[model samples]
Target: MQRIFITGTAGFIGFHLARLLLDEGFTVAGFDGMTDYYDVRLKQRRHQMLLQSPGFRATEAILEDRDALDGAIDAFAPDVIIHLAAQAGVRYSLENPRAYIDANVVGSFNVMEAARRQGVAHLMMASTSSVYGAETAMPYVETQKADTQMTIYAATKKATESMGHAYAHLYDLPTTMFRFFTVYGPWGRPDMALYKFVDAILDGRPIDIYNHGEMYRDFTYVGDLVRGIRLLMDAVPVRPADPADIAPGDSLSPVAPHRVVNIGNSTSVRLLDFVEAIEEVLGVKAQRNLMAMQPGDVPATWADASLLQSLTGYRPQTDLRDGVQRFVDWYRAYKDSGGLR
Candidate 1:
């Protein structure tokens, strides 16, 4: 069995991805800080579920602690490393810019150093659609220029991409950066819109609808997003022999074994339509609190995942209504079990 070291197994994406990989018969070593960004109970619950699998082992520690991170990675000595832990919230970054710099910048450097030392076959890290800041083009593609990141969170992720490219170029490390769209489904983050919308609607409270419910998002389901990551794990980039050898539409760097891929549903759904799906699933009309867009938030986002498809031969096809229903079902069950009140 191939051994894999994954950071942030307690996080929403990391939890789901670890489970999927474990089911596929991979040995996974998870690292997480279990921070109280949302609810530590929720994070603990995710880790507990993963522990049921004998293939899963975890260390509870923050990424900023280089010793802890290096210790875990050295002991595991994984064949591949997936760095997913980061201070993740666009709006929160506006409040605490230093947090992003610490976790995303400094902590990421630690991961890269570990990967370089371990000489892992591949290193995959998470980026976000937010990196496509200030771009109004339809269906954002991987090869597009994305320098204008409006939020600290997006800027930090962009910085990581640059850092990863430099490391790959220097060390010949095969690195892949996945630019994820708005992901949703069971075990989603509490700070996300879907979670907040469901919580407030079910409680008969007003739900905040930013951008007056006019925003558009390529809300890739959590399952689909993780599946994309799994497939891309095998689609590792290699340093191109020549700049012209890189395929058209490919984001591969000519000088390094590095590339950026967008994992998304590829279909943009209106914010109101998404809420309607939730309302329909819950059978409750939400008290809408329409408001102006939040700072550092884009009015719309869409992903052109053609590169992902050409590489992995898979695309995210989960319907918004179906995904919403699944989340609502999970939310209700979780609440009934006293996981949340």
Candidate 2:
């Protein structure tokens, strides 16, 4: 069985990914800081469930703690390392810019260093579509120049991408940076729009519709996103003998065994349309508070997942309505169990 070390195993994406891997008989060691960003109970609930798996073991520590991080990695000695833990919120980045620098930038550096020392076969980390800030292109591609970052959150994630490239070039570590679109599903983060909207609607509170509900997003379901990640794990990139050998849309670096892939639903859905699906799922009407665009937020995000499909022979195809319904069901159960508090 493959041994994998994953950061943020207590997080929304990490929890789901770990579950999938464990179900496949892979041994997973998880690391998480358990920050009080949202609800610590929620994070704990996730970890508690993962602990049920005999193959799952975890270390509770912040990514900023170099000693703890290095120690855990060395102990696990995993064949693959997936770094998914970060202070993740676009608007919150405005309130606490330092958090992003500490978690996304500094934390990611520590992981890269550990990967270098361990000589891991592959190092995969999470990047975001927010990195494609200020670009109005419909279906953002991996090869596009993503230099204009709107917020400190995006800037930090973009910084990680650069750092990963440099480490791959220097150490010959096979690295893959995933540019995830707006990911949502069951066990979603409370700070995310879907979770907030669902909770507020259920509680008879007004839901804030940013950008006057005109925004668009390529809301990739968590299941599809993780599946894309699983496939990419096997499709490791290699430094091409010649740059011309790479495909037209490939983002493979000519100087290193590094590449950036976009994982998202190819279709972009309007914000209002998404909310409508949520309302339909829960059988409740949301009191909408149309608000102006918040700082450090984009009006829309669409992903060109062609590279991901070409590499993995799979694409994220879950319909928004079906995915929202699943989340609503899970939310009801969680709320009834007093897990939402």
Q: Model 2, 195: alpha-carbon shift in Å?
A: 0.8
Candidate 2 ranges with C-alpha deviation above 4 Å: none
Inter-residue clash pairs, candidate 1: none
lDDT of 1 by residue, 144-197 (tens): 889899999999999999999999999999999999999999999999999999
Angstrom error of the Cα, residue 55, model 2: value is 0.7
What TM-score, over all chains together, does every model reach? 0.99, 0.99
- In terms of lDDT, model 1 sits at 0.94
lDDT of 2 at 24: 92
| Decoy 2 TM-score against native | 0.99
RMSD, candidate 2, Å: 1.1
